[model samples]
Target: MAPRPNIIRIGMLVYPGCLRSGAVMPFDVFHIANTLSGLRVAANRVHFDTCWLSARKEKTLTVGGLSFHPQPADLEALDALMLPGIDHQGPYDLSPLLLGLGPEQEMLRRYAQTGKPIISSCSSTCLVAEAGLLDGRRATTSWWLAAYFRKRFPAVTLDAEQLVVEDGNHVSSGGVTSYLDLALWLVGRFGGDALRQSTAKVLAMDANRSSQAPYIAAAMIQDEGHAVIERARRWLNQRLDRTWNMAELAAHCHTSPRTLLRRFQDAAGMSPTQYAQQLRVERAKALLESTKLSLEDITGRCGYEDVSTFSKVFKRWARITPREYRARFGLRQ
Candidate 1:
C-alpha cells in the first residue's frame, strides 16, 4: 500500500437510531485536532476531513431523535470509517435490531473488503459483529451487554474491561462515553501523538485511559454466581500482603478450587491472581492519591515486596507510572 497522506478523511455511520453524541464526538475531536494543528509547524501538522454518511440517500436524517444532514457513503474515498452506537436496551435479545440493519451490514461488508478500518463502540459493536466483521477478532462493547455479546459473537475475543482495543485496523472502544478515547486515538494515529495530547488538553480530556476497570461498579459484577467471586475478592483484599493461595481462597469462599477458578474467571473476566493484582493496584492508587508515601512503602502496602515490580504492575493497570499517576491526581500536602 502507498503511504497515507497527512490529511485523514474519516467517514461516520449515520442512521436514525444511533446516539447523537456518538456521531458528534469524533467530529468534535477531529475539529479540535484540525484547529490545534494550525498552530504547529508544517512537518508536525496533521489534519482531518470527515463526512456523515448513510447507506440510504436521504435529504435530512434523524439520528437519536435529532436531525443530521448526511451524504450517501463513498467508502473508497475515505481513509477510515466509524460506527456510532444504536440505542440498545440491555439484558434483552438484539436479534431483531441486528437483522433490521440489512443495508448497513452490506455497506460494512463491502467496506471491510477494502481493508480500511471500521471503528465502533457500545451497541453498534453488535452491529459490526452481526455483519461478520468481528469474527476471529478481539473486540469490546458496553460492559453491561458483555454476556450477550459473548454468547452472540463467540468467535470474537471480547475483553470488556479495556477502555479501547486496537486489533489490526479495527479499533473497538468500550461504552458510549469512550468515543473520546477512540477519537483521541485516531488523532494520534493520523495527526501525530503530540497533536493528540494538545487536543486532549484543550478539550480537558484524559486521553490515556487503558482500561474500563476503574469505572465498572462493584455491584455490576455481583450478578448470578458473583457473590462467591465477591467473597473471594474480599478474602484476597484482606490478605494482599501474603502470598496468594487458590486453595485457601476457595476454602474461604466455601467452594472447591476448580469451581472457584471457573466462577471467578466467568464473573470477573480474569483469573484470581489477576484480580488480586488489580485489587492491590487499586489500593496503591488510593495511597498514592492520599499520602506522600514513598514508592517502597506503597509497594509493600499493595502486596509487592519490591518497588520495581509494583511500579510495573501499577503502570500496566493505570497506563502510567505510579509517580505520574500521583503527580496528576494526587492531593497536595
Candidate 2:
C-alpha cells in the first residue's frame, strides 16, 4: 500500500468577545469538507484537527451569547490559524483576552515569519495588521471599517469590495459572508476542486462566481442613460421571481425596447435578458444556501419554468451543476 498523504491541521483561535458568526462560519465549512472528503480518502489521507488556542484556561467563555471551551494544544502543530473578528468600539480598545504578549501571540508571530497560511475575517484583520504581518500586502475587512483600517494600517493596500484578499501566506476577508468565500477558497486550495465543489453544494453557495466590478463600473457612468439601466436592475431585483419582458420593462421605463437595449448594453455591457438571467441564477443560489428547498422548487422560485433550463443557467453562471453546487454548499439533508 502507498503511504498516506500528510494531513492538514487547522487551528482556530477563540478569544473572548469573538464574533460567533465569523468563528462558526469557517468551522462549519471545514467540518463539512472533512466529512465529505474523509469518506473517500483514507483517514490518514485527509484529516482536520481543530484546536482552540486561547490564553486563558477557562472551560467556557461567553462570546456573542455563546459559550466555548479552549483546546489544549500548542499552536506550532497547526498548518493554518483562523482569527475570527471580535467586537471593539475602536482599534485602541483591545480585547482583554488579547492584552498580553504570551505564548499564543508568540506562536502566531512565529507562524507568520515562517510563511504559514493565516486567515482573518472581519475585524480580525486588525489583529494581524497590528502585528505588521500585512505590511505592503493587499487585504480587506468589513466595509464599514475600510477607512479606519486604511488609516491605521497605512502599509497595507485596502480593497473594500473584494470578498477576500490573498497576499502570500496572509489572507483576509470582508464582513461575515466573505468568510464562506475564504473557507471555500481554502477548501479548493487544500482539498482539490471536487471537495470544494462538494462543500459548496452542501452550503448552496456560489464560490467565486460573479464579478462586481462590471456592475460598479457601469453604475459609476452617472448619466441619464445610465439611470434607465439602474432602474432596470432595481426592477429586476424586485421581480426576481416573475418572468420579465423587454417591451414591458421598456414601456415602464418610458422608452422603446430598442432604446432600452441600446442604453443597457452601453451601461452594463450586457443585454437586459442576460442581466436578468444572472439575477435569477443568483437568486437560485441564495435559495440553495439559505433554505431546504428542492432543486425544482428553487428553479421555479428563480422563474425557471423548466428544470433543465434552470440547471443550464445555474451551471453557466456558477461553473458547477446545480446538484453539485447544492451538495457542496447546502446543509446535510
**Predicted model with the maximum TM-score:** 1
lDDT of each: 0.82, 0.73
The sequence of per-residue lDDT tens digits that candidate 1 reaches over residues 232-293 is 87788788888968888888989998998888777766788888887888788788889998
Residues forming the 10-long window of minimal summed lDDT in candidate 1: 216-225
Q: After superposition, how far is residue 213 of candidate 2 from its true place, in Å?
A: 6.7
TM-score for each prediction?
Answer: 0.71, 0.58
Residue-level lDDT for 324 in candidate 2: 77
Candidate 2: lDDT over CA atoms?
A: 0.73
Candidate 2 residue lDDT tens string, 1-333: 755655777777777677787777787888898888867746334656566667566777678778777776565677888888867765445434345434446556777865778998878887787777888999887755654566667799977566678889998887756777777877887888888888899999887543222212222222333568768878887887887688889987889999998886665446889888877876776677778888888888888788998888877656667787678777776
Residue 110, model 1: lDDT of: 94
Residue 277 lDDT, candidate 2, scale 0-100: 81
